[model samples]
Each structure stands twice: as structure tokens, then as C-alpha cells.
Target: MGDVFAAVPGAVVDETGLQHLGNPLAEQRRLAAGTALAPRADRAVIAVPGEDRLTWLDSLSSQALARLQPGVGTELLILDPQGHVEHAASVLDDGETTWLIADRADVEGLYDWLRKMRFRLRVDPRIADEFAVIGGTAGALAGVAPASPAGLPLVWTDPWPDVSPGGWAYAPVDPHPGADRDWSEAIVTRDEEARIADAAARGDLQLAGLAAVDALRVAAWRPRWSADVDERALPHELDWLRTAVHLDKGCYRGQETIAKVHNLGHPPRRLVALQLDGSGSVLPDHGAAVRVGDDEVGAVTSAALHYEEGPIALAIVRRSTPIDAALTVETADGPVAAAQEVVVPPDAGRTANVPRIPRLGRRQASQ
Candidate 1:
């Protein structure tokens, strides 16, 4: 069944485990209209059973999950000791168990970590290889089931638009881009994947690839663990406080850093949207240098060509960078001028409704 779709025109399987079906731009359109799906081979699922599943996870991660009701969708981040994002997962519970869908590269480590942390708890964690992940918009998956033949298909609906309980929004816009990112991922069986592949073979399934999905993600200013995060990534820089981090949550691995920064400091860097020159078709590669004149102020985290908006990218720039600065991204051939759109503004800090204590500078001025 896989071979049948592998032979689809321009079907190239990359290391990311997503097969691009030739026209990514066209795929983007189909995806937006809720007619396309991306078989996400790059994802893996973990199952946690026992009555203590929800509270056990709530005690460890960055989200406030003490009350994550069944069929509800949310996300949590496993932060390093320093509050840096180490692993991220989309979470869902179906009354009996909790499902965690994370990137394949990080899932194994996450599984191991969860096992080690299960001492004296009722949590039993294991890799759910029987399941495959399906990525598409909410409307496209309107009728999708939460369970499949393989097992319980925990559906992780993205909860980015709303300021989840105990979460904060750093995006100051009235209607944030996240409001339109109806992205979702479903856990299904091998048989289901085959069924979709067979449909594609018969010209029935309009499928897209990582390229199309990622481009829209960039356009939506959404942060991805694989592309946007490094060893030093903090949730504040990506404006991820909107969904992933629960500032008031109980102590976890990186909670200290999260508190100190949001209360008294700024993230050393910030996320910016880059509009690459569309004069040529070549898109800048990941890790491309984002420069101000000859000095590299930041590096491109993700780059893609959108369907309606052409040649857009996301880069993490220095917090002190001028908002109106005209920047350039280094491509293989040459440099392309990039205009910076502030995703995380220079002053993005302490977004919660915590009461304010005037800083020393303000007191001194009044004195």
C-alpha cells in the first residue's frame, strides 16, 4: 500500500517522513479548504493508562492539566532544568487514558523520561506503534473518530487560538493568526494509512506534504519543536506562552526560569516573520543567516513559500533588534532582503494579568 503511493508523481520521501506529492503550493490550498491530509510519519504516539494518568502528567509538565476533561485538546512542554523547551507534545485524553503525540526524534527520550518519572505513580507509558498520525484541518477531520482498529485514536486538536486556562497570550493582535490555524492530528491504524494511500493512488485523496503544512505554520507564526527550538529555546521567545506554558502551574523542571524571565527579564532573542524576496524561486535554507548589513543578528529557523503569500520565513532575532530594520537572509546563491515582522516584540514579557510592582527606575524618577 505504501509502495503504491510512493510511486505517485514527485512522491519523494525525505528524512522528515512526510512525502511531498509534487505540488506543495497546490497542496496548501487543498489543505486550507479542508480537502487535503498529510500522513505524518515523522510523528509518534505514547499511551498512558491508569486512573492517575491526567494528574500524573499535570504534576510534571508545563501545562495546567489537573482538569483536562475527556475529548479536550491541549499541549504541554517538558522543560529542561533551566525551563528550556526540551520536548513538546499535543495531548488528549479519552476518559480511560492519555495520548501524547510528539515528534519521532523526541518521542523515545520523552518515553524514557516519563518511565523514570513514574515512581510510586499509577502511570504506564509505552510507545503506540500500532497507530499512525493524520494531519489536517479541523473541518477536514470533522467526522474522524477518536478510536480506530489499531487502538484508541486520541485526537489532539490544536488549542493555540484561545488563552488556555493558566496560559498567556503574547500576541497583542485582536485576531491572532493562531485563530485560523485549524490544524489537527489524529491517531489511526496501519490499515487506515493504507486506505488513505489507496485513495491517493486512485486520484481520490488530495494529499499535501511537510512543506505545505510547514509553510502555513510559519505564516501563522506557529513554533515547531523540530525547527524553531534549540538547546537554549525558552517558551517566551516563540510567544508559546499562549498555549504551551501555564505560568501558574505548580513547580516543574523549568518553572524557575519561566517565572524569573516573565516577571523581571526579557528573552534574549525574539521571533520574527521574514518575507523573502520573491524575484527568484529559490527559498532560503533552514539555519540560514539573518543579517543586518554584514553582522548576523539571528538565524532562520524555518522557511517556506506560501500559496497566497509567497516566500515567507520565520527567524529568531535578537530582542534588541529594531522592529523596522530591513534584514537579509543568506541563501545558497546569494542574499535576499527580508522584512522583519515582529512576532515576539522587543518588550514581550510578563504577559499574564499579574499585578505590577513599579520598577526601581520608575520610583527613582518620581523621587
Candidate 2:
């Protein structure tokens, strides 16, 4: 069934379906304008069924899923004890089942972890092989109905850059870049996948690729699990607290660290959008060194050429790196000069104001 996309004309299929037709920039414009659909063959789906699903997931992850109403789209992150992001999932519930769309590379590990955590719960978490995903803006997807098993469409809308209920925002920018992003993903059956592919093959529907999706995502300052995350990633570091993390939610695995960091300290690193010098016509590869003079400050996580933004990238840099600092990205071709646009600022956390308690017994005399 996946090979159906490979038959579509001009598709550059690798292991993932439809990398791009040819021009990613033009494809990005088409995708953003709702004229094209991108086959998200690079994603995996997981289904959790049973009456206990919502509360069970709410107890385990960062989002407030306990009272999740049907057909509402949200996201969650599974964090290690020290609060490093372990897994992330885009979530949508159809009243009877909770559907999770995750990156393909992390599916097996996330599924295994979910199985291990279902000790006494009635929920059955399974890797849903029968479901696949297609992505576009809500308008682009309106013509195509998502799979509705329990009278609700199984579509996961991205809530990026919005402060969800109980979530916090650290980025101080007015009119956030993601405010204009209207991306969503629909869960479809194998038959539906074939139907879409057939439409593309007949030139009845326009098809974009994952590359175009990435370009638009990067332009919107959207952080993707597959591209923006690393071993030491924290939700605050990526401005993911704007959507993914519920700072006031009940205690979960990483709640302690999440609270402490947001209230008392700063994230060690911060996310930045880099406007690369397009005169060289070279986009830095993933993992390319991001440097300020001789000091390598960080690494490029994702890079792309947008329809309007020319060359751009998202990189993780030390929180102390000056926001106004001019940066350079070391690419295989040469060093590309980059101007930093702050996403997560250096003072991203420390929301709480806790007064000192006179340093135990030593400071009483000073008054």
C-alpha cells in the first residue's frame, strides 16, 4: 500500500514516501496555500483503546489529557526523570479510542515503553498498523474526510506556539510565527491512502513532499520531534512549553524537574531560527556546527529553503549566547553566515519569585 505513492509522477521516494517532486520551495507555497497534500508516510500511528485510556495517558505524560474532549487535538511528551524529552506524540481522541501520531523512528521505542507502563490499566496500547497519515492545512484536508470510527474524525491538529490549557509560554514575541501555521494531520485507512495516491497519479490532486513540509515547518518556527530534539532537549529549550508541556499539571515522571527548571532556573540551551546568507546557495546539513567566531555554540537541527524566507534553519545554542549575535554555520561546502532570530530566549524560565529565607540563621543580624 505504501508503494502506491512511489507510482505518483515526480515523487522522489526513498525509504520515506515522497521526499519532494522537484522544487521544495514551490511545493512549500502550494502546501501552505492549501493546494497540495503531503503524504506523511514518515509517521507512525498508535492506538490506545479501553475506558481507562484518557486518565492513564494523563497520568503518564506532560499534557493534561484526563479530561480531553472528543476530537480535540493536542500533544504530549514523555520525559525522563531529569526532564529530558524521551518521546513525543501528537494526540487526538475519538471518544472510544486515543490515536497517537509519532515519528516513525521513535515508534517502536515509544510503543514498547507504553506497553511496559500498562501495569494494571484496562487500556490496550497497540501499534496501529491499519492506520496511516496525510497532512496539510485544515482547508486542504476539508475535501478529504478523515477516518471516523466512533463518529469523530481522527485528525490531529498541531497546537504549536499556542499556550495550551495549563501550558506556559516563554517566547515573548508578539504575533508568533506559528500563529499563521494551519497544519493538521488526518489518520486514514489503507484504502484511503490508495485513493489519495490514485488521485495524484491521475493529476486530479496536487501532491507535495515531506521536504516541503519541513521547509514550511522550519519557517513557522515549529519544532518537530524528528528534527529539533536531541539527547539534552527540554520543553522550555524549544519553546515547546507553549503547547506541549502543562506546567501546572499533576505530577508525572518528570514533573519535579519541569517545575523546578521553569520556576527557579533557566534551560541550559535555547532554540533559535537562523536566517542563512543565501548568496552561497548552500543550506547547512543537519548536525552541522553552529559557531560564533572560534567557539562552536551549537549544532544545526533542521535547515531548508522556504518560498519566501530563502535559506533558514533551526539550531540549538547555549542560552548565554547573545540574542543579537551574528553566527556562522559550518557546512560541507563552506561556512554560511547566519543571523539569529530568538525563539526561546536566554531568560526563558524562572517564572516563580521565591524569596530567600535569610540564608538559614546567618542573615538575621543584617536587618
Q: Per-candidate TM vs. native? A: 0.91, 0.94
Candidate with maximal lDDT: 2
Overall local distance difference test of candidate 1: 0.81
Residue range 1-367, candidate 2, lDDT tens digits: 3467988888899887689987888888899999999999889899999999999999999999999999899999999999999999999999999999999989889999999999998999999978889999999998776899999888889988777998887666666667789999999998998899999999999989999999989877888888989889998899898788888778899999898888889999999888887776778889999998999999999998878867888999998899767688998788978877778778777663322221112111112
Cα deviation in Å at residue 265, candidate 2? 0.4
Candidate 2 backbone overlaps, count: 0
Model 2 steric clash pairs: none
Q: How many backbone clashes does every candidate have?
A: 1, 0
Which stretches in model 2 have alpha-carbon errors above 4 Å? Answer: 350-367
Candidate 1 lDDT tens digits, 228-263: 999889999998988898888788888999989888
